[model samples]
Every structure is written in C-alpha cells, then in structure tokens.
Target: MKKTKTRLAAIAAVALSAVLACGVLAGCASDKGEQKASEQPEQTAAASLEGKSLNIYCGAGMTKPFQEIADAFKAQTGCEMNITFANAAQIQTQINTTQEGDFFIAGSADELKPVSDYVATSTDLVKHIPVLVVPADNPKGIQTVSDLVKCDTLLLGDPESTPIGKIAVKAMTDAGVMEQVKQSGSITTSTTAPQIAEALAKGEGDAAIVWKENAGKDGLTILENSGMEGYVKTVPSAELTCAADADAVKAFSEFLQSETAKNIWTKFGYELV
Candidate 1:
C-alpha cells in the first residue's frame, strides 16, 4: 500500500508538470503570433510606400495619376493622406506665404521650382513643355502651329499670371503666331486651362490656347507647339514639408516621372520636354 501510494503521487506530479509546460508553450506561441501579425503590415509598408500628405497646386491636371500613387503608398505604409488641389501659381503663392502642406505640384516648373527651392529638391520634380490646347472640332481648321494665329480667329487662354497662359504665349510667339493673333484682335483671356477649354466648348472662340497637356483632349485639338524655337515647357515639382512619410512622397514623386505619367501627358496632347 505504501508503494502504491508513492507510485500514485509520482504519476500525479508528472501530469501536473506536463499541464504546466503546455500552458507556458501556448502562452509563448500566442505572443509570437501577435508579434508576427503586428510586424507584417509594417514590413509591407516599408517595402512599398506609406500614407502621407500630398498637396498639389490647383492646376495639376495629373491628379488622377498622382492619386493612384497616393493610394498605393497608403496601402503600403498604413498611413493617412490629405490632398488639396488648387492653382499651381496660387498654390505656390500660398506655400510661399504660409508654408502649407507636404508637397506642391504645379503646371509649370517656375511654380514648382520656387517652392522646391525652399526645400532644396527643385530639379527632382519637373517636366517642361509648351502648353498646347485647341477646340474640339479643330476649329479654324488648325492643322499647324501657324494656323492658330489666323487674324480673325479668336483664342482663349489663361491670364498671363498662369503658367499655361505664359507658356502658350511663348510658344505662339516662337511660332510667330501669337503677335499675329494680337494684331488681329483675337486673343481672349481666362484664368485657368479648363476655363480656356470651356470657352472653346461654348463657341466663345475659334480656338483655345492652353497647356499642351490640355491638347488632344475631348474639348480641344492639339494643333502645334513652339518646338525648339518657339516651344514652351511646363515643369512639375514636389516638396518635403511635414512629409507624412518620406517613402510616400518619394514613391509619388517617382510616379510623376514614370511611363504611366508620360502616357497621360501624351494622351492629353502635351509635348514632353
């Protein structure tokens, strides 16, 4: 009976020990699983991009393209993003005045560079070209750059303060057509590229002069550019102010330079400079 009691006690002790060991193992496994799950998303984001703040100048027609990049970055980084679009020129003025947002994208390099210069990342974000836009029906039978200068033809463009207008005027002048339009009393003015297209759609003008990227679109035809002699360029840039995540901005900026971005620019009838 004593031996039996001793044997029974030994068996009980072994069972309790086994149970305790299982509990400890399970606890460790649970902790490891939680830790692994927590690290997975972070690792994925690091490999791709993080969500971040991306403010673009109002005139940035490439919003759709950029938006795609922002979305990707967000998924990769698990961060948040707030995007605000406004006139590139006005946006620049705002950035210069108040120093707002994480990045600034403009219709022209002038606007992008100014803000970028403040951040020392100017050249990394620029695409230059003469802005070209026209009516949807190819009104004035615009086949060449010279046709845009028809004496009786009306041309709508952004105000001189806007990059689209600035480049349009430069290209037309380089093509020896802008002065002719002025001589013919055909130049009209709007505040933005979309406005110029709107005017043309309304039959307010014989043709429209806007950013080259605005050309060949539904509202307009792409007549011509100033080229080497008369071509103007639109440059775009990015900023680094309060960047939500460095990778997000970097990936997005690179997206602007990607083939997809180039395709968008070309489809819009813009000359890639």
Candidate 2:
C-alpha cells in the first residue's frame, strides 16, 4: 500500500509538471502572436503599396507643396507618382477627355464639378483664399479693393479657366466693384494662378488678385482687409474612377490628408481646412 501511494504521488507530480510546461509554452506563444499582430498593419501597408504607381492631376499653384508630399509618400510606400500640374479648370478638362488619372487635386471644390461623375471619393484638404497682391512696398499705394481702379494695369486670372479668376469676379461682384475694376484699368488675364503671380513678380501689373498662398512669393505683398474675407474656396483631393488599383488610390488619398501632408501644405502657406 505504501509503495502504491508513493507511485501515485509521483504520477500526480509529473502530470502537474506537464500542465505547467504547457501553460508556459502557451503564454510564450500568445506573447509572440500579440507582437506579430502589432507589427502586421504597418508591414501590410508598405507591402500593399510597394511597386504601385499613381497618376495625379494637381493644381499648378500647389505644385511645390504637393511635390514634397509626394516625395514623402513615395519614400514611405515605395509607390511612384506621375503628376500633371495645371490650372484646376484645365485639369478638369483633362479629366473629362482622358479619363485616365488616379486622383485630382483641385484648387477649389467647384473645379471638381465637371468631373464629379468620374470621382469615386472626394476629401477637402485645404483652404484657397483670394487676396489682392501687389508689388512689395505698395508702389502704387493700393490699399483696398476699390483702389484697384486707380491702377494703370491690373492682372487677373482668366475667369473661364482658373479658380482664382472665378473667385475674383464673384468677390468683386459681391462687393459691387466688378464693373468699376473692369472699366478702370487694363485687365490682363492669365490661365493659371501661378501665371498671375509671375506677372506680378515681373512688374506686369500694379495689382493682381491671386490666391492668398501665392501672395507669399518674392516681390509680392498681400493687401490686408482688402474685402475678400467672405469668398474662400475649399481645396479638394478626389479619387478618380479610372484608378486601376483601388487600394493604392485609397492609400494615397488618405496620405494627402495625413499630418505629413498638412505640414507640407502649411509650409507652403496654405491654410488647413
């Protein structure tokens, strides 16, 4: 009887040891599984986008900032970006004709209207405010919107082909000064906001109405309280229907609103939406 009891006790001890070993092994495995799960998302994101490519239609005014954002995106995901920079209206026309872009980044939501059917998703990214820009030092003493009439030459974006141009007309009309502006000075129109800024830099006009961000360029100064506070436009980035890889497009669209992209935009003087 004593021998049998001793043998049973030994058997119980072995069984307990086996159970404890399994528990420890299971604990280790569980820890390893959790660690792997924690690491999976980032790895999966990079893997999914690696070697993918996207075609982007970006506004000409946003070129500098968007290029930086694109560089960051490519570095993170290993994706290639093929960007086409033009005025928002011109980009809209291109989208309608080609139907071959992955995304469209416009200066205003209005520019997206013509290509609405081709858009799968749209996200407002920044604010595009119109401001009166003049040569540094206020050479013409142009201090107000109404004062635009006193200028010898005025530069404006083409109302038919640029978002800034459309906003310029509407804002002035809302202020009841559009007719006066048109009648007083020789108005020169450009197809893009950058062109207007360039013209101003080259001393092509005494005053020019361009996007607020462009007013930061060298040799330009924004006129404070120029009465354009009410006419701000929202910049939008849209995913197009032509995106061959929806996953890749979605990833990039998300990146456009990421903190990194926001920093880039702000660095270029754009206001966050």
lDDT top scorer: 2
Error of 2 at 151 (Å): 1.1
**Candidate 1 lDDT score at position 273:** 58
Tens-digit lDDT track for model 2 on 76-183?
A: 898999999998777888889988999898888888889999998899999988898899977789887777777788899989988888988887787777898787
What's every prediction's RMSD, in angstroms?
8.0, 3.9
Best by TM-score: 2
Position 262, candidate 1: lDDT: 65
TM-score of each: 0.64, 0.85
Candidate 1: list runs displaced more than 4 Å: 1-58, 123-139, 151-153, 224-234, 241-273
Q: Which stretches of candidate 2 lie over 4 Å from their true place?
A: 1-37
Predictions in order: lDDT: 0.61, 0.87
